[model samples]
Each structure stands twice: as C-alpha cells, then as structure tokens.
Target: MLASVAAGLASTALGGAASAEGGGVPALQLITLTGPGTSGGDTGPGELLARQDAVLAKVGNPTTTYRWTTALNGFAVELTPEQVAVVESDPEVASVEANSVRPMSARRTPVPSSAQVRQPRATGGAGVVIGLVDSGLAPESPLFAGVPGLGRGPKDFAGSCEVGEDWPATTCNRKVVASGWWVAGFGPERIRSSEHLSPRDAVGHGTQVASVAAGNAGVSVRMRGRTIGEFGGIAPQARIAPYKACWGAPDPRDDGCATADLVSAIDRATADGVDVLDLAVAGPPGTDTVERALLGAAEADIVVVAAAGNDGREEYAAHGSPWVTTVGASLGSVWQGRVSVVGGPTLTGASRSRRTSPPTRLVLGADAAAPGATRRHAAQCRPGSLDAAATAGRAVYCERGGIGRIDKSEAVALADGVAMVLGNVRPGPVVDDFHAVPTVQLSAPDAQRLTRWVRSHDRTSIRMSGVAPSPVAGRTAAWSPSGDPRSSVIKPDVVAVGDGVLGAVPDQRGWAMFGGTSAAAARVAGAAALLRSRHDWRAPVVRSVLATTAVPLGTESVLRQGGGRAGADVRGARLALVVRTPRYREVLESGSWGDLNQSSVLVRATGSVTRRVTNLGSRAEYFSAQAIGFTRHRVRVTPLAARLSPGETATFRITVTGPSTPGHVDDGWIRWRGARGSVTRVPVAITR
Candidate 1:
C-alpha cells in the first residue's frame, strides 16, 4: 500500500511535465550519482531503477540505457532539457554531462630494443591481466593462442566472454580471459555491415594493441608467404581482457567511441580486476566524466596508460591527466628502401613494401598528368590524374598530402606504373605504410632534391631494393604531439618505439606494421604489467618507477620526452615520490595534476617542492645527489648526501629559482648515487 501511494505521488508530480519540451528528440545525458544508493552493496538494480523511474516520471520515464556501478556510479538516459533539470535537482546527483561522442584517435619488440639500442631481458609478465579498452579483438589470430606451459587462468580474474556472431564462448581461452563489447551509446543505426556484432574485431586496432601488449611468444609473422621474423608481446605471459567500446565506420576517419561506452568499459574492467588498462583512444582534457572514471580506476589499483595524440607537435598531447601515463611515439629499428639513381648516389628512405623493383624509367607525377587533370592533383597522384601511357612501366614520384598514402599507390597501380617514390613536402615523421605497389618514402629535403634531378634530366632511371632493418634509435617521432604548457603535470610521461611496429591484423595469419602512439601505449602497458607481476606495488609507484628510470631519447625538451623513453630499470633503483601532506591533498583533491605524488617534477613557476624516497634494498647505504642538464635556471637540492639503513625512508627538498620569462622552459635530471651501487634519476621540467 505504501509503494502504491509513492507511485501515485510520483505520477501526480510528473504527469504535467511529460511533454514539457514538445516534439523534439530527447538528448542523452550521463548522470553520476554519489553519496548513498550508488554502489551495488548500497542499492539493488531493481530498487535503483524504481527510484529513477519515479524521478523521471515527470518527463515520461525513458529506459536507462547504461548503468555503470563499479568504476563509476553513473547511468546514461535520454531526457529532455526539462527532464535533465529534474535529475540535476536530485540530491543524489553528483554530475550531469551530455553524452559526447568523440573520434577514435588511432611497439615492435617484446623488450625495449632494436638493432642499434641495447636490449633488456624480457620480463615474461606471468599472472598479470592487461585490460584493453578500445575496438574488438581478432580471437582467431594465433597471437592470442594459449602458451605451451600456461596452466589455469588467473584466479583473481572474473571476466567473461559475450558470445556473438563469429565469437563463441570457447574463443575466450587462457590467453584471452575476457572479451566484451558495448555499442549502445554509439547507436545501432551507425554500425556498418563490415563491423562485427561481437568481440571479433572487424577493425584491426584492438587486435594490434593486444598483440603488442600480451600476445603469445615466438609467433612467426609471415607476410606474403615469407617469414619476416619471430615476434612476440613485451609481456608475452600476461593475460588479456579486451573491451570493445569504439566502432568502425565506412570512412575510417569517421570511426568514433561514445563517451558513455568508454565509461562503462572502464567500470567493467575495474570490476574484472585488471592490473593494467591500455587506452589507445583520445578524449577531451580536464576533469570530465570519463577522466573521473579513470581516477576511480587508479583508486582501484589499476595502472592506466593512454596514447598521446598523433596530431604532431603543434597540438598538446591528449588525456594529460596525472593519474594516467600518457605515451608518445618514437622511431626505433627502421626498414629503409634503397633507391639508386642509375648514375647518381643511392638514396635510402622509409619503406613498408616488401617487393623490390629493378631499374625503370622515373617520371615526375606532374609530367604524367592525364588530359584535363589539375597539376596539383597529378602531383599528389590523385585517382584518375595520371595518364596511362605516360606512367606505364615507370616509377612515378607522388608527393605526400591531399590523399591517403595507399591511395597514391592505388592511382599509380591504376596507371600501370611499376613502382612509386612517395615523398613528404614539409619536415615531419615519415610513416612506412604497406602500399599497393613497391614504393620508397623520402623526407622533404630528399624529395625536393629528387624532384629537381628528375626534371633536370629527361631520362631518369632508378632501382629500388631492400626493406632491411636500419635502426634509428632514441629520437621521438615528430608526429607525436608535445606536452601542454598550461597543465602543471608534464605529459607524455614516457616515449616508446611506435614506428613500424609489426603486429597482428584482422585476417587469419595476417601481420602488418603499425605506427602512432597507440602502439607506444601498448608497449608501456605491457611493461607496466611486467612490473605488477614482479612486485607488489601500488599503481602510482609502478608509474613512478618507470618514469624515473627512463633513459633520455634524443635532445628534445621534457615537454616532448617527459622522462625520456619508457624503461623499467628498477634493479637497485630507489623509489622517489613527491611528498603530499594531508593539507595539500585536501587543497588539491579534484585529482590535481600538480599534487600527484610522482617522481618527475614539472614546475610551471618558480617554486620549491619536497620528495621522499624509501630504501627497498637489502643493505644500508649512503647516497649523493647531483643535478644534470639544467640551463637558464637555478636548481638547488638540499641534503645533497644522506645515509640510510635498509627499509629506511628519507626526505629531500628541491628549490627552483629562475627568471619569469614567458614560454621559456628548462629541463634536467635529478640523479642520486648510492654507495651500494644503487642509482636513481628523476626528470625535471621548469617553465616560465
């Protein structure tokens, strides 16, 4: 009788507002509830739905599409503006945000090494679970097959597989412990026929990421019926749990992930007990609803790694929250194609093509223009711009830009061209994409020189061969964006080898080279899983350990390389964390980037900060501190030397006093050496 009376009161209160906005479609909003009745222990799903239904009765109670309770206490619902106002007025609501749809922002080795760099022993990440929150997976690929010695699945993991078309419950094996997909917020009408309805990856992004993070070891990557090399994941023994939140579209660039779906995936992964979360997708900065869920994930002891956007140095890195480790792309072991000018010096450039071509006549793209085609179009090798007669049996030079790199090769193939020489116009990183025909890619200066040589002589012939490994170690890729000056926390906390990383594709037995920070994040995520498997540490400690021990990659500023390349040299390395007192924590409690207890330091203004380090070694030792690489600023460290016993903790202070010049930045490292051979380094960035 009491329940009937409450329902009657709700109807009376909401009946008039049912059609308050009149006739337009309702907008979806994500509402995060707090206080009581948020967690599963506090409120049952049925009871919560009844409460929500009564509250939303004023606006014609729509079905709640998503209910996130683990990592985030939120629900997604379609409501009119008037209805949103009603929800906002409720005392349980913490935040109400419009469901925002964002575009999908789309690592070669098991350990961090190439032909030129020193190799570290691979740490098989046994008993670790890496949760990938991105596109679906290719369950049939051999990369996700069970290992030889692997026994039972992880005891702590409670994730399950969602059976769908081409995806059976049996697909989730010991290697892939969990598989699921959420596309409710992405809308069913937007899903294309080419995409899968299950966790099976129609788009290859998720598979590539999973392969780089935790695929089976010693898998042969055979392309075009030839074995390229034996490849494996950095943490080959770790288990994978993939949650597909992003969906494919007809236009590849139109591929996007709904924010509502992202939050739900994060929530589920947290509940599933994943040790590491690899997020390759990009989203807006600051404390939005999604970032809030990331904080919840961190609080749940999950180490989150995200991709620094591929927008290049002009834009700031995305997902710059201090809680998540943002990773940038860097070129490692490179495969170059050699183009020998019949009588001129041979030019070596980036290449992903496996085929080699003998000497053939080379023609400028503009010189082979079809009738009625614009010179610009012909130069860019746009489809239908090349004349078949002029381009037949010749190596066409197509300038980068205007169209897809593969599209240029397609146009060349359509013109009966035997080969292509693709070149960039401006200074930037050259991606080695697998093309339709044999091709060579050159930088701006080299391309300009080649163009001049081609036009100067009437008959220019060139021979293209070799796609062998030529290591370009350490330098950060130009396409990976720099850190934001506005944020207090330095972004791109580490760099990883992202260029020309070979990984699994959607097709069975297919492998391809991938680039961008997506690959870099996977590498770091794998490394984080390795750390978790080796030691019992908190998420923040794991992040600090990686950042502090990173080796410098090139001469770029900390804004570009942060703590240099992502490395795990924790052997005899001291753990340093920024000291944050209770007062400071309360003052900056909104997941403050500046207040994070990270080892790396980023001083936007002249200020003094304190750090604490604990000796995790077995014996007592004395340590000395020294500053390296600092210029244009006064960096002083107090207590330059300290003596501590095993398991002892010590505190130190670092003061930065410098000119308040705008846009001026300085970088260096705080190195500490212990008498017992212990060494630790912390990256520092100061900006004015």
Candidate 2:
C-alpha cells in the first residue's frame, strides 16, 4: 500500500514542486525543446543529444539553467513561460512534461545473498563490470573497500571519477572504479550549497543501490544502532562503476536526474566496456531521450535493467522501453510491529514512533480539520488543515490513496495527533513503509470499515503491538505490476525480491532499509553480471536464460509474474533453454481489441515465425517445446524436441492461425525442458 503512495510522494518531495510561471514572468521549470537543429542539427540519439549543449546555451544562462534530457530535440531548461511557448511553437517538438524523480533500496540480497545461501562461501560475478547510474558512490564503505581477491576492478573497464571540490581526486578506488554526477537540475547554486562538491554520495540512494547489486560480501546489517544480520549484494565479485546521474540526497531528497545527465552516463558506461547497466530512475512515457539511449545500450550488447515505476494505478507508467529488460518489485519475507483498530483487522506496516499511552481516544482526521476544508481533505491529512484544538494526542485516521503515508503521519503529528492509522483505498494486501510517527496501514475493506466506524461512532479505540511475519511473502507488489490495459506490451519482463532490502548508506558506518522495484532491478542486474562471469552470452541470451530458468510463481498472471521470480543458477543446470521468438509483450501488442478475435483480426490469418532455442549448458542437451495454457489460436511447432551441442542453438518454426472468437487474453507459454528439471517458459498472450 505504501509503495505506491511513496512513489507519488517521493516525486513531489524529492523534486521540489514546480512553481507555476504566473504573469508570463520568467520562472524556473524544466523546458523540453525539439526540432531539426536550425542553427546546427545532429543526427541519431547520441549526436542529437550532444547538440543539446549548444541549444541550451542559446536559450538560457548556461551556468544557472541546467540542461536535462539527453537527445538534441528534448531538454529541461529554466525558460520563461513565454520561452516555453516559443519552444512549443516549433513543429518538431514531440512532447513536453514537467521533470520529476522517483524514490527508488537493499538486503542478503535474496541475491548475492541468495547465491551464498546456495554456496555459502562463494562471492559470485568475478571479472564483470557493473555500472550504477544513480547517486554517486561512497567508495570508503566496507562494501567497496579493498580486500585481497575482492575489490579488484575489471582491467578492461575505462572510466574514472569526476572529482568534486570536496571529493579528493583519489576517491576512485579498485572497487568503486569510476564515479560521475549530473546535477544539471533546476537549482544549481542551491544544489552546490547543500550538496558535496564531488561525485561522492551526499545523497545515499546511489550508494545503497550500487551496493545492493555488487557490494562486497560480509557487511553487517544494523538497526537501532546494533548489528542484526549480515548483508551482501547479489553479485559480490562484480566491479562497480558509479555514474551519478541524479543528486541531492541525504536531505530534501532531490533526485531530479535530468535526461542529459543520464544520456552522458549511459554513453560513458557503454564505452567503458561495462557488462551491465543498472538504473533505478524513471521518466515520462513515450520514446524520449533516455528511452532511446537505453535502446542504444541494448543494441550495444549491454544488459539494461530498469524499475517498473512505483505508480501502481496507471498503466505503462513504467519508464521501460521495448528493448530494455524491465523488472518489478516483489516482497521479501519480513516481520513488523502492528497497529489494528478495536474492531478492525490487523495491518502490516512499519513505524519508528513510540506510543506510550493506552490505545483509546480515536479521532478521525475529517473531524479535526479547521472549518471550510472538506472531510476528504481532513482524511487526506493535509498540512495545517488539522486543528490542534480538535485532535490533540489522539490517533488520527488517515486515508492512503490521497497523500504519501509518511506525509500523512507528519500532518497528523503536526496537529498534535499522537498516532496514525493509514487506511488503504485500494483493497487487498499492504506493503510496509517506514514512518516518522506511529503509523499502520489498513487494507481496503478494513480501512472502509474503519472510516464508517469513525463516522458513526463518536468514540473509537484500537490495539497495537508486534505482529507475526506477513502472510504474503515475495508476492507481486500491487504497484510493481504494470496495469495499463491500453498498451498491449507486457511488462515487467520478470519479478525479483525488492521489498525491505538492506544496503550501504553514504554515512561511513550507516545502513538503510529500502523497498521498491529499484532494488529488484539491481538484483537482476547483479544476477546478470554473475551469469556474465560464468558464460559468454549475448544480451538476449542472458535475458532469455534468466527468464527461462526463473522460478515461475504459479499464482499471478503472465503479465504480472512474467517469467516468475528471478533465480539464475549458473552452476545448477548443464543445459538451459533460451527463447528467441515473438516476445510476450509483442504478441499482446499485435492483438486487436486486446485479443485475437474475429472482430479484432477478423480475417483468419496465418503467420509463420521462427523461434530460436539455445542450449547454454556445458554439454549437449535434449529439449522439447510445448504450448501450454489457454489456446486462443492454433500453434504448431515443427520438430518440437531436439538434441543440440553445448553452446549450440536450434531454430523451430511456429505456425499460428488466428481464431474467430474474441477474448481478454489467451495466455500460455512455449515451455522448453531439459534434463534435471532445467526449464524455460516464454509467456505468450494473444487475443482474437
């Protein structure tokens, strides 16, 4: 519940709210420019973006107005509202949106930690380079400190730290091989005043995410100022090159990493010969600058993994393009303290607030707001609206869908409310969130009942205490799944454990708890790095192997779970099936009315597509393919089973005939299996 809420709040809180340009006066807002370069134009995503430096210089004071967005046509500059209008007048400008950043965390890493779980002594991902494109790195963290066999940078890597005034020139070390920052955001002087002068992570997010992907092994997890458990990254042996695309962390949470900065980092990482690029950032939809850059990275043989945005409500809100390997957030097993209503259900949430008084004197926020504000605003717990006279030292009832859960807690506490009960607007399940005051989120039905009770009953009370581990462990987080039905493209390509993962903070000895698809993408990136270390595979092969070998979650739909939970056991299988054919999402996009029906694809059409299956094991392997799930159309695979040598690939032709009927989605997978349960499932969704 909080993950989706936090996503919105994170955008608002991290990137300061954009002040409107009133009276046609000059104001600071991100402006995107597009068109053929009149003065000078560059072709292609890379060259076009390089031309942006010149375009930005022409529009505003270069030093103060930061240029965002990578490609030549798109940019975020502080232009006058009139100047923005001037840009809009250009026919070439594709689209423009206000710039913002998403809050994106650590744990054993069910990762690099999971790798150790299977082989306790092994630190996976030797000889691979992983580039972290987020906040800069804290090279001094124990996770990045030099050690014997560990901490060695990949010799082929060719990137260096962009030193800051505060960051010593020697900041780049063997473990943190490279570092750079793109702070060309809305505010520069203010950013410099509050931010460190170098690529160092004053904001802890980049460090935390990088460490989660390839941090050194055997770091300890601390809470309440004491060690609770040992922490590790997914691929402990991979080299880390920090690319600080976003900045302003550790305070005010300014993660407004513009597109220009991201483009530079990605281009640099690709040139530096990194094996994988890990990004925890997101941008507006459509094929924008960074989206194009990611596609370029994919074509260059680099594995690009990105987060499915935290927005659970909108469809295709995720920043992922077609080629990138998109990942979604799933729960990791966790136990947290509970806060339940007197007659309501137990809720799963986290808070640092300590409640000393007996649970009683329940007061709803709508009842506490100052006069004139609607009950809805009161339930939203808008700041300053709550009257201290009405709700002093009582647990305030707040709704989840309106504002960030933490923001709600702050508003209630500001009103002198002792605690907060966050009721979820969307029913079914809750994701835990860290809070400033005593806060617990209720599920939908429970929240609805709590609201009715608050309206009907003058007095309400609730019980609070520690609770058992959440019953739903490692389930697809509601916000993690892409719900946009308008776009037929299936997403997240796969799911990974992201909730409550632990990783390093910028503070020398500090650590943090984060929950989002950002962490999930990092784990998958690290897993890919681990695979890179063991096998010489193309980007598609790596993606296919991971998807095929993943532990399929049987409950969720193919769109929700994709290939299931990521579990790439490089050491486990002697033969793995890698799918190369119509992508699951592509088939979905091809359907009419979102299905292969007579009204949609009215003509019964026949199409033949070649599916390539590769055996990536150490020896020759035998395999067969079967179409399982709903049969909306007829599919025939010639030579269903085959024997192939190690590293050899076989091609199978699949003939499909469109059906006469229409349906939501005909879901199934082309399953390929080998000895020892080595299996690969290419999820298929077509309607007619």
What lDDT tens digits, residue by residue, belong to model 1 across residues 1-688? 1222233234323433444554434666888765222322356556665655555565566556677666656677766677788788987677789887776545222222231111323347788899998888997777788756543356677788876778888998888888777776776457778897677888788898898888777676665455545677888889999898888877766677888788888888888889999988766666677876776677667888989878874678887777788898877875678888988768888775556677899999988899999999999999999999999989999999999887899899999998999999999766555566788889898898898888788799999986676757668888888887767778889988886666788975477666678988998998898888877766777877778777787678888888888855565566545332222223334545454556778887688877777665667788899888888789999889888786688888889887777878888888888887766777888887
Query: For every model shown, what is its TM-score relative to the native structure?
Result: 0.77, 0.65
**Model 1 per-residue lDDT at 192:** 76
Which ten-residue region of model 2 has the weakest summed lDDT? 595-604
Quote the RMSD, in angstroms, for model 2.
12.1
Displacement of the residue 377 alpha carbon in candidate 2, Å: 30
Q: Give the CA lDDT, 0 to 100, for residue 9 in model 2.
A: 27
Angstrom error at residue 520, model 2: 0.6
**TM-score, structure 2 vs. true:** 0.65
Which numbered prediction scores highest in lDDT against the true structure? 1
